[model samples]
Target chain A: MPKLWNETIEEHRRAVRDTVLETTAELVAEQGLRGVTMSRIAERSGIGRATLYKYFPDVESIMAAWHERQIAGHLDELADLRGRSDTPGARLAAVLERYAFIQQQRHGHGAELSALLHRGGHAAHAEQHLRHFVRGLLAEGVQAGEVRDDVTPDELTGYCLHALAGAGELPSKAAVRRLVAVTLTGLRPQG
Target chain B: MPKLWNETIEEHRRAVRDTVLETTAELVAEQGLRGVTMSRIAERSGIGRATLYKYFPDVESIMAAWHERQIAGHLDELADLRGRSDTPGARLAAVLERYAFIQQQRHGHGAELSALLHRGGHAAHAEQHLRHFVRGLLAEGVQAGEVRDDVTPDELTGYCLHALAGAGELPSKAAVRRLVAVTLTGLRPQG
Candidate 1:
C-alpha cells in the first residue's frame, strides 16, 4: 500500500479505538459496570459489533483498557506538575494536592469497579511507576532542603501515598486539601 | 427456677458462645474464609450443630461476632494505653504504636474476610469510636503544647489513622514503628 494510505488507515484505527474506550466509560458511568454490554458499547460508539470485537474481546478487556488509559493520564498530569518552574516545595504541594483530588474522584467509580480494576498486572505496574515518580520528586525536595531527610525517600513516598488515600473518604475538596496539608507537614524538617 | 441454677445456665451459654467464636476464627486462619462452615465450627468447638445454630445462624454471623470482639478488645487496649500515667506525647506514641501493630496483624486475616466484616454497622461504629478515641488523645497533646494546634484534632486523627494504615503493607514490625514515628512527628508542634 502507499505510505499515505497506510498512515490514514492507522489513524482511523486509533480514532475508532479511542471512541470505543470513551463510549464504554460513559456507558459504565451511566448504567454501572454490570449494566454495560459489548453490543451497547458498539452501538454507542457507532462502530459495528465486528469492528468492536476486533479491538476488544469483551466488556472486561475494554474496561481494563480504559482504566489503563486513566492511570497513564494521571501519571502524566503529575509529571507535568513536577516539571513546573517553582520552588521544590511548591511543586511537591501541587503534586500532592492533585493526587489527593484524584484519590477523591476515584471514589465515584464504586467499589465493584475498583476491585475489578485494582487486580492484575496493569494496576501493579501503575503503582510501581507512581511510587517511583513520587520518590523522585521527594528526592528532589530533599536535596533542596525542603523535605525532611530523617526518613528514606522510599518510606516517605509510602507515607505520602498512604496518607493521601484517605482523601477518598473525605467529604469535600476543601477536606482533601486539608488532608494534603497535614501530609505535607509530616514531610517537613524536624526542629 | 432458683437464682443459682439460672446463673449457672447463663454461664454455660456464655462459654458455648465464646467457644464457637474462637473456633471459627481458628478455622478461618487455618483454611481461609470459604473453608469454614456451620458444621465445621460446631465440630471444632465440640458443640452440637443445633446448639451452634441457636447461637449463630451460620459461618458469617460467627465471623461477625469474632470481628466485633476483636475490635472491642483493640479499642480497650488503646484506651488502657491512653490512661497510663505518662506525658501526653508518650501516651499518644504508645497508642499509635499499638494501633500500627494491630493494623499489621490484620493483614493476616485475608482480604475476603476483611471485606465481609468491614461492611455493615459494626465496622462503622468501631471506626467512629476509634476516631473519637484518637481525637481525645490529640486534644490532650494539644493542651500540653506537645502536638500541633494549627490543625483540628479531628483532622489530625484522620491523618494519623490513614497514615498508619500503611502498616498493613509494611515488611516488618520495625517498619511499622518507623511509620508510627513519622506520623507522630507530623503531630508535633511546628518550629
Candidate 2:
C-alpha cells in the first residue's frame, strides 16, 4: 500500500475504536454491567460484529480501554490545573475539587458497574499514578507552609484521596467544594 | 402449647438462625459470592435444607441479614468506645482509630466480597448511622475547640469517614494509626 493509504487506515482504525469504546460505556451506564454484550456494543456503535471484534476481544476489554482513557484524561486535566496555579496548596485544592466532581458524576451508576469498571490491574496502576501525583503536590504544599509537616507526604496523600472519595455520594457540586475545602484545612499544620 | 415450651422453641429457633447466618458468612469469605448455595449452607450448618429455607429465602437475603448484624455490632463498638473517653476530641479519635483498624482487617476479604457486602439497603442505613455518630463527635470536638468550627459537623463527619476509608488498603496497623492521626490533624483549626 502507498504511505498515504497506510496513514489513512490507521487514523480510521483509531476513530472506530474510540467510537466503539464510547458506545460500550454508554450501554454499560444505562444498563447494568451484565446487560452489555459484544453484539449490543456492535449495534450501538454502528459497526459490524466482525469489525467490533477487530477492535476489542470482549465487552470487559472494551470497558477497560474506556476506563484507561478516562484515567489518562483525568491525569492530564489535573496536570493542566497544577500548571495554572502558582501556589502549591491552591493547586492541590483545585485538583481535589475537580477529582471530587468527577466522583460525584459516578453516583447512581449502580455498584455492579462501578465494580466492573474498577476491577483488574489497570485500575490499580491508575490509582498509583493518582496517589503519586497528589503526594508530589502535598510535598510542595508542606515546603510552602500551607500543608501540615507532622505527617509524611505519603500519609497525607492517602488522607486527601480517602476524604475526597465521599464526594461520590455527595448531593451537589457545592457539597463537593466544601469537601475539598475541609480536606485542605485538615492538611494545615496544628498550632 | 405451654408457655415454657413456647419459650424453649423460640430460643432454639434463634440459635439455629444465628448458626446458619454465621455459616453462610464464613462460606462467602472463603469463596466468592457466586460459589455459595443454599444446599452448601445447609450442609455446612448441619441443618436440613427445608429448615435453612425457613430462615432465609435465598443467599442474598442471608447476606443482608449477616450484614445487618455486622453493622449493629460495629455501631455498638463505636458507642462503647464513646463512653470510655472523657473528652469529645479524644472519643472521636478513638472511634476513628478503631474504624480504621476494622477496615484494615477487611484487606484480605477480596474485592468481590466487599462489593457483595456493600450492595444493599442495609449498607446505606449503616452508613447513615456511622455518619451521624461521627457528626455528633465532631460537634462535640468543635465545642472543645479541638476541631475546626468553620465547617459544619456534617461536612467534617464526611471528611473523617472518607479519609479513614483508605485504611482498608494500608500495609499495617501502624499505617492505619498514622492515617487516623493525619485525619485528626486535618480536623483541627488552622493555626
Candidate 3:
C-alpha cells in the first residue's frame, strides 16, 4: 500500500474506534451490554462489520474499551475532589459528593459500567482503580485519625462505597446526601 | 389423560424443573451464564428439546422460575428480624449478619442473579422483591429506634443492602464479614 493510503487507513481506523466506543456506550446503556452485537454496532455506526472487528476482537473488548473511556471520564470528574481541602472531613465529604453524583447520572453509565464488569470478566485495571481510590481515602482518614486505625483504608473505603453503590433505596440526591452525611459523622473517631 | 397418568406427569414436571435448575447452574458456574443455551442445557440434562420447552416457554421463564425459587429461599432466611425483637440495634445487627451471609453467597447466587437481571429481562418482580425486603428491614430498624427515624425505612434498608451487595472485594467470607461489620456500625443511630 502507498504511504498516503496507509495514513488514510490509520485515520479511518481511529475514527472507527471512536464511533465504536460512542455507539457501544449508547447501545449498552439503552439495551445493556448483552444487547450490543458487532453487526448491530456496525450497522448503527454505518461502518462495515470487517472494519468494526478490526477495531474490536469481540463484544467484551468493545465493552472493555467503553469501560476505560468511562473510568477516564468519571475520574476526571472526581479529580476535583482530590486536594479540595487539607482536612480529612472536607476531603471525605467532597469525594462522597462526587461518588454520589456519578451514581446519579441519568444515562445509567454507573449501572452499565457495573454490568460490564459483572457480565464480562473482571478487568484488572478496574479493580486496581477501585483499590487505589479506596486506599487513598482510607490512608488520609487513618493519618488524620478521622477513621479507625485498626482497619485498612481499603476495608473502610471499599465497604463504604459498597454501601453507597448497593443502596437502591437512596433513589434521589437528597437521600444520598444524607447517607454521605451519616457516613462521615460515623467515621469520625469517638471522643 | 387419565387421572393417574396426570399425577405421574405432574411429578415428572417437578423433576424436570429441578434438573433444569441444576443443569443451568452448573453451566453457569463452569462457563458463566453467557455459555448457557437451551440446546446445551437439554443435552447436558439428558432431556429432549421439546421437553425443555414444555416446562419453560423460553430461557427467561426458566431463569425467572429459578430466581423466584432463590428469592423465596432468601425471604425464608430473613423472616425473623421483624417485631420478633424489641430493640432495633440488635435486630439491625441481626439483619446485617443475615445480609452479610447473603453477600458471602452472592459470588455463587449473585452471579446467577446478576446474569438473570443483566440478561434475563424479568426485572420488575426482582426489583419489587428487593424493595420489599429492604423496606421491611428498615421499618423494623426505625420502629425500634436503632436507625434514625428521620429517613424512611425504604431508603435506609435499600442503601444498606445495596452497599452489602456491591462488596465484591476478595469475594471471601472473612472479607464480607469485615465489610458488613463496618457498614452496619456506620448505619447505627446517632448518640
Instruction: State the C-alpha lDDT per candidate.
Output: 0.90, 0.86, 0.70
lDDT of 1 at A128: 97
User: Model 3, which residues run further than 4 Å from truth?
Assistant: A1-70, A106-127, A166-172, B1-9, B31-50, B57-61, B80-86, B109-113, B121-123
Q: Candidate 2 residues A1-191, lDDT tens each?
A: 46798899999999998999889888987886888999999888899999899888998899889988988998899989999998997898888889889888866676666777787788899899999999999999989988888878998888888899888878878888878877777788755
DockQ-superior candidate, 1 or 3 = 1
**Docking quality band of candidate 1, CAPRI definitions:** medium
Model 2: colliding residue pairs: A162-B162, A186-B186
lDDT of candidate 1 over B14-94, digit per residue (tens): 999899889899999999998888888888899899988899898888888899999999999999988884898998999
lDDT of 2 by residue, B100-132 (tens): 888778667777666677778889888998988
TM values, all candidates: 0.91, 0.85, 0.71
User: At residue A187, what lDDT does model 3 achieve?
Assistant: 62
- Specify the poorest-scoring 10-residue window by lDDT in model 3 chain A: A162-171
The interface root-mean-square deviations, each candidate in sequence, come to 1.1, 1.4, 2.1
Angstrom error at residue B18, model 2? 2.5
Order the candidate numbers by lDDT, best to worst: 1, 2, 3
Winner on TM-score between 1 and 2 is 1
